[model samples]
Target: MLIPLVLLTALAVFRTAGALGVRRFDGWRVSAAHAMAVMLLFTAGAHFAPPSVTVMPNSADLTAMVPPQIPFPELVVYGTGVLELAGAAGLVLPATRRAAAVCLALLFALMFPANAYAALNGVELAGDAPSPLVPRALEQVLYIATVTWVAWPARTRPHPAAPGRDADRATGAGRRS
Candidate 1:
């Protein structure tokens, strides 16, 4: 709920900035990447947030969300926060954008089960009701799709004289019947 809103707000801001002459966000892909990075940073911060906010997951809530089988739930929460931070940084760098996008998409997929577990079991945090599974699942899917889109490589075109050289009409030197 709040996550998507954050992503959308960041996207709108970045795109508008680009339109208004911010060279870094001049393209849609760049804007989207930056927006997701902002969103990830927000989530990562939540992993370290104290148990004071009802609107977001805190460290304890996040640890409890992990299924019983997993060991050291606290460490998992912290590690994921670190991963999110790394992903956010990677997204902003041109050289690492694709890898980061792919990894983030996979991370979202892997993290869904914890969200599901928390929602299904009515795990409350900060005196708030448990998160609903359906909405959370939908949001996860949307995030996965967004990052997957970012991971797609740009298309490249071939040079004019590579292989199937359609010779110039005036010269007609390499034309094949």
Candidate 2:
């Protein structure tokens, strides 16, 4: 939680400073992206760990508490881990960052059920003493917000070529007189 927040803040600061192509800030931006991705991977690992090893009220804990409707908890857990790792990897690469952001957003949405269960059951979280349903929901919301902030920069579409640009002209020439 704190780890993601700190990493995101540092990344945002570095990105803002690097807007003008400051050399030192570029290094920071790259470092920050790697750091954030690694932290997210760690988070994913934590969620996928077994019940005995996983801390309480986290994703794994919630998954453990719910009655197994499916035949294979292990498979589900590991599959989610794979997605998280892949998404984190994608986030670190310039070409795949936007896709990764979408993946993460979908992941967050998929986990909402477990989050709701944790809150409803008043489960004790890893760090928190014990919290009510609303606070638990809020905690999940905060995580969602943090992840969204980190991924927001990757959401923009590339700028179109300028008017009269050669590439634009090449594509449009056949349609014009």
Candidate 3:
């Protein structure tokens, strides 16, 4: 819930800024990429934060969500957190944004089983009620959709002679052509 809210709010804010002439965020895809990075940073911080009833679960507490077959659950939690941090950084760079978005999509898919396991077992973290599997799965799908939208490779650089409208649409500007 919080994760999607963060992603969407950041996206809306960034996209609005782009509409207002912020060159760095002048396209929808770029804004989405930046929003995803912000969300990833929020999640990654939980890996190191000390556990508390009032805050998110720490990485160690996240071990409870791991499926029984997984080894070193704590390490896995921390490692996934590190990967999220790396993905966030990668999404901010033009050269790496597509690759990072693709990887994060896969990460969301890979992490789904843990979500399911937690739901099935009623595993609670940070004193919150266990997240229902259905909603969690839907959220995972949303994450995948957003990340893959950013990951979709551009076919080619627009030929210099192409119409600006065509180029803008290709870059996800969402402007009328």
Candidate 4:
């Protein structure tokens, strides 16, 4: 929990700084995108920590708690970690950003079930109990909103021939004049 919160704080700070720098210094979209990608990578990496046997019992315990459920918890955890890393890498490059954003949105959705389980079952963390389900649900909703905002497309480059394209249109560039 602390790890994720710390990573999220860093991401917010870097995002703000990047937005300010890009707006003021100009021509910084690629740099900003890269910074965002790195932040996400760190955030995603935090999730791979071995499950808390104390808080979240082992697979056997989980089965006891909620029996007849999916059996491969380790696989789920590692697979999610790998996807997150890949998505973070994809977001850093301009050519793959859009695809990365879509993947990240899916990832967020995919993780919701685990979050729900933790909240519903009162899964404890290192020192504290699980958060209230309502707040936990709201937090997930906020995460989804953030992902959506980050994924929204914006024009990164000024159009060439800004003035001349209008003139060309008046002179019937698209038609016989």
Candidate 5:
């Protein structure tokens, strides 16, 4: 949504301004990785929110997105929430970042059905006004693009190693065999 777009853009700017570290953010990859991870985690947390609250799409709404044939739509939401959390964590780690991005990208693709249903049905998400079909479509496209940015090969490793960390890599003294 617009929230993620703005957040990611702000992060990229901060990185470019040298607030994040010495090695600047590579515009999309690093920025998207961190920003999307945060966004995922945010959304995942909403799944556990009380039903009385309307901060996110209601369970009934989400359930409606599932085909009637699916036995338990609530389970789907819960499961996807867990998956998003795991994926979010993966996005922040070096070894798993790329793999996570791939899976999250696929998840975004797989999630389209619900999104389409919402758009067509005029379902507002996160208390936001119902997004028009064109905007909804554009959002999907942006989601894919953000995932691509997150999944893209790191142009400059996204971020530099922590202070003294790169040196450790050179010596291997801190590592155990």
Candidate 6:
């Protein structure tokens, strides 16, 4: 929950900055891509991070957040971790950004059930209780919406150094014998 909030806040800042003339992040899609990439990477690291003495749990502790109805909760946690990491990596590339965003949005939607179970049944992580149900649900909704927005394509812009541009020319890759 905290992570998602941070990501959303970061997105807001990026958007505001872009509006104020930060051309690099001038588009919502680009901002979303950057936000999701960073956020997902941060969360993904938890899957392999060392155990802590806080409310937040280690990767294995994620099983506790999953409802009992779901078999192999731990595996789900690991799978989600890999998915998030892959999504983050894919989000950076212009060719795969949209597909990755859509997939990540779907992943977020599917994750709501686990979050709901956590709230309804008092799911805890390393002694850390989940946020209230209403807020958790609301956050999940907003998260999914934000992820969906990331699927929107940024306007195309060829890099300054492309195959026939600066870098490729210097590297001679664009020059055919």
**Which one is best on lDDT?**
1
| Model 6 agreement with the true structure over 1-177: per-residue lDDT tens digits | 668776987789888989999986898888887787888887777666556635456775667778788898878888999999999988878788778878888898898888788888887766776668898788777767766777774468987765666787788776778
Off by over 4 Å in 1: 52-55, 153-177
Tell me which residue pairs clash in candidate 2. none
Per-residue error (Å), model 1, residue 120: 0.6
Clashing pairs in 6: none
Clash tally, candidates in order = 0, 0, 0, 0, 0, 0
How big is the positional error of residue 140 in model 1, measured in Å on the Cα after superposition? 0.9
lDDT of each: 0.88, 0.62, 0.88, 0.59, 0.71, 0.79
Query: Tens digits of per-residue lDDT for model 3 on 59-135?
Result: 65578899989998888899999999999999999999888988998899999999999999999877789889999
lDDT tens string, model 1, 8-103?
Answer: 999999999999999998988889899999999999998898777667779988888999988999999999999999999999999999999989
Per-residue lDDT of 136 in model 4 = 66
Better of 3 and 6 by TM-score: 3
Q: How far is candidate 6 from the true structure (C-alpha RMSD, Å)?
A: 9.2
The TM-score of predicted model 3 comes to 0.84
Q: Give the TM-score of candidate 5.
A: 0.71
- For model 4, residues 88-143, the per-residue Cα lDDT tens digits are 78866667877777887787777776767776887655446766777766766665
Using lDDT as the measure, what is the rank order of every candidate, best first? 1, 3, 6, 5, 2, 4
Local accuracy of candidate 5 as per-residue lDDT tens digits, 1-177: 655675566566746755556454544567667777777877777666666667666555566566555677799888888888999899878688878878887888887777777778767665676666676667767766776776767445434545476768876858988
Q: Would you list the rank order by TM-score, best first?
A: 1, 3, 6, 5, 4, 2
Task: Name the regions of candidate 3 deviating beyond 4 angstroms.
Answer: 153-177
